[model samples]
Target: MKCLKSLFPTLMICLIVFGCTNEDIDENTVNESSNKNYNSPNYPIKSTTELIVEYQSGFPERKKEDLRKKYNVKRYEKCDCTNSRIEKWEFDPRVDLEGRNELITQEGGIEGTDYQFFYDNENSTPGVSGSTAAGQSDLLISSYIKASNSGVTIAILDTGINLTRLPQSYPFLYGTNSDMTLCEEGEETEVSGWDFVNHDNDVYDDNGHGTVVTSIIIDKLFDEDISDYQILPVKAFNDLGKTTTFTLLCSYLYAVDKPSVSVINMSFGWYGPSGSLFPKFILENPDILHITSSGNDGINNDDNVHYPSSYTSNNILGIGSFSIKKRKEIVEPLPFDSRAMGISLLSPREIIKSTFSNFGVTSVDFLSVGDQVSFYDNNGNHYLVSGTSYAAPLVTAKAAMYYQNGHITPTAITEQLRLNGTLLAYYSLPIYYGDRIIE
Candidate 1:
């Protein structure tokens, strides 16, 4: 998991060489100021109140032209546009249709048959480790919190969640939709969500990475032993566990709009700071809390911090991983070189008894699932899991618990966690020079 850092090529070089220096930048700044009021709307555009409709049966196969005319839909070369067949439709603002899509009967199908409405509901559970003291202790402490997360919403910007695989007894641990049924009268319902990879509403978890992360936070909240927290699963990465900058931005925008969402857990990272899209957004909205991973790549010869985490923002909490004793065995220290100086906390990263860690690592003589191993549930059902991807959720869940109890702010939480982190003499050296061990 070395951080990927490619040197800037010709394009970047040209930008740097002739890019606005202080003298030339003044003219650009003047131009920006002069046009600031022009074309800028006096008020925010009224956002359309739209809902997604998930067809129980996949879209009917028919001539594209005929289908569009009959269903009042439009076919397009791409699905990203407003009039596309799979595009979101805006209904009347005055009407409350439970976010359901109205259906019309066709010559071959029945009319008035209701299909499930798909809203942009961030969904997923957090993966829980059954071993580590922090993991187990947090579970025990959550019981006394008495918070059910009925009103609070937590957004997981990860792979996705497998609703079918979740335990039957703990339905709330799944997401906004509990029974896997359509919108209910009293029960929590899916708010709104999207799949950045497919650009569709189907953000299902093909990769177990997301399922593991989601389980950590959701499981703790809903476990009869702990408090219940609402989950908003926003799938940014695909099966390959990769995503582009644009897609990640879209997911962040969606999280920002979630009315009930108070916290966002981003357990992913990229190298180098390009633009400040995420940081600027968080700065604009100071109330939301963002928790991000400090990255798993052990420190390199150079001591550069990772992006997003490196962004100096009070709203963001960067996290690192540590190893703890589990199952009568002492786990080895994480291979990642730690450089989180200002605000970062280190937690266990060994093969502890987590929902996703089933395979034993021989190198460390530990027995828990690896980043690519599949793990089973308490009942013996199995799924694939791996990575620092899973560790981030454990921290996110604890942060949620702290937030639920009103114990800390986003900035304060990181301060306390880092201040309380067990200091290691091994991390005292300069990561790059690898010589002096400064206290």
Candidate 2:
């Protein structure tokens, strides 16, 4: 997601908890968190100060030995889980703030109509949280539930959620066990997540970035009965809102390894080649849909490549942001809203582009509102946020719903999503928005 530049003013006194959160903030500032643990010696807890070599699989064992002998390596292993042969030899990687979620949020408030779109009726009234992204797409689920997409899971690789803030009424979170100490591959109990920063099982958010982001994934709907849509939160960032490549790699590897997870929402990104390891896994695991923000950087991704976003893999869908403006227009016989609200609009809905959304004809796939969107914090306080960060998850939620309609695999979901997408005609865009999905 694009980094938020400022805060929306006018603090409303309600935590509206229906439909995906609505955001209309400046600089596209969406909240994101930061911590836990690797128990095995081969996969020792990753530290920014610690370094390793990212290599392809099948390099000679002797060559690795020579490198180890030359560098006097502290530890080395060819990781099999995340991706191909990675010669993880010890060195100083100089892990900095590069891995942190670029999402931005300032201390402030805002004034806007909190329009919460309900299950079938319009939740015109906003709650303690804020508005949702659900209505924006004209994409609301059925008044009932089905098992078409049952057993689907979404892995959120970010800071982590606030544990104490679990919902009492219903469950939007997954994993019963919180003990991350016995984090062995394919362990006995179902694992929620691990934090590479603090090297523990506590994936809870220390800074609230992860919590807000996770909320954006499932908490923005008025119909709170979205069962079987599970959230697996992984804390990849630290309290400083920063992380290392190694830490991110672990999170990605862990997420893909899970069979239940068909969709992965990555609202964070870096500027250059994130190595071939991630893309390699994505291709091999074509069943999983890996989606990421085109980046919050306000430059053309074509000219300035943003890794993951700039990747050429078919499984990866690079997303941009657009503040879906509701404009009044006059048709041949009647007047209409450009981006219609309330009941679902027809195919190829009116197109409006967000000035801050990053785009590339070759890289970007879709655009959602990346402006000031509203959501709940760890304390359930309602506030608006913006950025590509929020937009990615809004798309994720929609994709999960699509899977329920029988489009399951990455290939199927991607095509079906584009099939029903809202095509943007306002400008020459990289992403192809269709009429099938949104209407």
Candidate 1 Cα errors over 4 Å, as ranges: 1-151, 173-192, 222-225, 300-302, 325-375, 378-386, 415-439
Per-prediction TM-score, please?
0.49, 0.64
lDDT of 1 by residue, 1-439 (tens): 1121112111111111112111111111101012223222111112234432222234453543453355453222222212222223344556443433343323333222221122221112224222111111223222223233364567888876554443433434223334333221223223334556655544566554565666666654554244545677777876655564445655676666655577787876654432434556667666676766544444321234455555556666544433233223223443434444321224322112222211111111111112333345555555433344444565566656666666446665544444443333232222221111001
* Per-residue lDDT over 1-439 for candidate 2, one digit per residue giving the tens place of the 0 to 100 score: 1211111112111211223223334432332210011111011122443344544346566665765565455666443233434444453355231231111011011111011111110001112222221111101111111223236788888766564443323445554333332354333222355655555555656655565566666654324345567777777775545665555666787777665788888776655444545555567777877778765545577666766766777677777777554434323321335355222333223344445556665667777755666764455555666566667787787777777778887667877766567543322223322222221
Who wins the lDDT comparison? 2
* Candidate 2 residue spans exceeding 4 A from truth: 1-51, 54-67, 74-87, 91-150, 165-169, 176-191, 220-225, 326-351, 378-380, 427-439
CA-lDDT, candidates in order: 0.42, 0.52
